[model samples]
Target chain A: MARLSDVIEKFIKSLLEESEGELELQRNELADYFECAPSQINYVLATRFSVSHGYYIESRRGGGGYIRIVCLDVDKNNFLHYLVSEGIGSRITEHDALHIVQRLLEQNYIAPKSAGLIKSAITDKAIGIPSTLKDTIRANILKSMITAVMAWQGK
Target chain B: MARLSDVIEKFIKSLLEESEGELELQRNELADYFECAPSQINYVLATRFSVSHGYYIESRRGGGGYIRIVCLDVDKNNFLHYLVSEGIGSRITEHDALHIVQRLLEQNYIAPKSAGLIKSAITDKAIGIPSTLKDTIRANILKSMITAVMAWQGK
Candidate 1:
């Protein structure tokens, strides 16, 4: 049985996919359709549709309140630089890292084999340090590798 | 002035470089030349010239005993596969991982950019786990990435 959260996430993703990575949803309508509380919608947005997951969500609270979701666009020229300074920062979790990698793959910034290499390198299993330090190291490694790619690509 | 151990390491490396990665040395004689204890020579070999560092050492004991050091050769065809099964195994330290990357770079099996990416992926900073689990994860990641490279290269 699929969890409500998972189902909601999938539904929203499908909507985004269909709408070309941008969409607006009425929280009340979605809640009613799923027979769930609006809070469930909020939960889904906060967790599965967060910036870390390559999404930017804006919620308006009013009579006409709506949730606006936008997928982060990868600017071909500056994305690697952006990722180093902003996307990865100094710390990153495995989930967030994987999401970023997924986005890169989707954008065709890296080949499938390269994507696999990145995933293998950044996976939680590979970064087998104390929980406190894992994210920091993952960030460093990811940044360095991205820089390497940029150099290779002559960017 | 460089430390005795460093000097000895460099001297041996130069010898190997000159000899096409194979050399034989009598420990006592080298120690006398360096005006140091034989144990010091042993220290340099143990620390700087281990198999993990991409050099293999064989010691023959007795009057005719000699220390033979051979650099690990990367067989262009099956090296990546060999690394997954034999070289990387279940666990790997940063030092060992770096050495493998270096060997690949030297052998021209990977481009500089790909080398940079591989190094970044396997580095300790990237694998931010506990010391105990770090090596195992590093091994997994290195193996996976190598497999990725192999695929990309159509090997």
Candidate 2:
């Protein structure tokens, strides 16, 4: 038999896999199932499923209350292949794009030097436009270009 | 007479300028010089010099301990160029990959239509992969493709 926590973890993961927009659960019901304290469920949620870990959670109080989770799915392999087929088409934003680069750098998927270059290119102030639209356009263009390059490599 | 707080701020900034990496200081010693409470020094550090303000500070307490500060000269422009030269490989999901695209668009480094296409391409249905690997792959491919395109553009 699995530990209550492990079982709960797997249960949540399965729910995430099946759910479309979000996943929800009740603390008391879950506790009853595991024959453990409600706090244990909270602990698992806090540590195992977090935004940094690519999961989002929400909870409610009172009757019919439940906890909800959302998983952010981003594959690490074969991304290059997809981008190449996608093609570079428009502008991209500084903030939106930097997160992607940061994550890649964090995972050691790309070189630090490369991360720096991408940051500079995407956030270059000289691009010349209304400040509001700059980041948005930069992000689009970056996507298109990256996709194009990836597609070319695929050939 | 110069305000004690002013003196401390200048001292820290000077240390940042002279030091190659991070700077360290003692809270009690600084407090003693300023003729103020230790918390005052803490206040100065929190306000005047912060990681978000391009400086990182860390401290330890209990017998002969001190604070450490690091200044990060984040040259956004140069960093992007370096990123392009390096590479991102692997599969990634649409959401994470879009971040880079968005940043590039914001900075006016890329166009708009390109971003949309990339977004559409990286979506779950488009990539056809398990949720867990989507973001990771998206990040990797996004970087790789972008670097490749940037390289071609240079040539």
Best by DockQ: 1
* Candidate DockQ scores, in order: 0.23, 0.05
Q: Model 2: per-residue lDDT, tens digit, B1-155?
A: 99777788898888778876467788888788778999998888888875334455555565557788766444543444444323333444465566767877787755554454445444555434344645544544355434333332322
Of the candidates shown, which would achieve the greatest TM-score relative to the real structure? 1
- Candidate 1 lDDT, A1-155, residue by residue in tens: 24678889999999999999999999999999999998999998998777756789987898988989999985765988889879688898887898888877767887676676787677666554446677777787788777767776653
Give the clashing residue pairs of candidate 1, or none: A128-B129, A128-B130, A129-B128, A129-B129, A129-B130, A130-B129, A130-B130
For model 1, the stretches where C-alpha displacement exceeds 4 angstroms are A129-133, A152-155, B1-81, B89-116, B119-140, B147-155
lDDT for B72 (candidate 2): 49
- What C-alpha RMSD does candidate 1 show over the true interface residues after superposing them? 13.4
Stretches of candidate 2 above 4 Å error?
A1-78, A81-93, A123-130, A144-155, B2-9, B14-20, B23-155
Q: How far is candidate 1 from the true structure (C-alpha RMSD, Å)?
A: 19.2
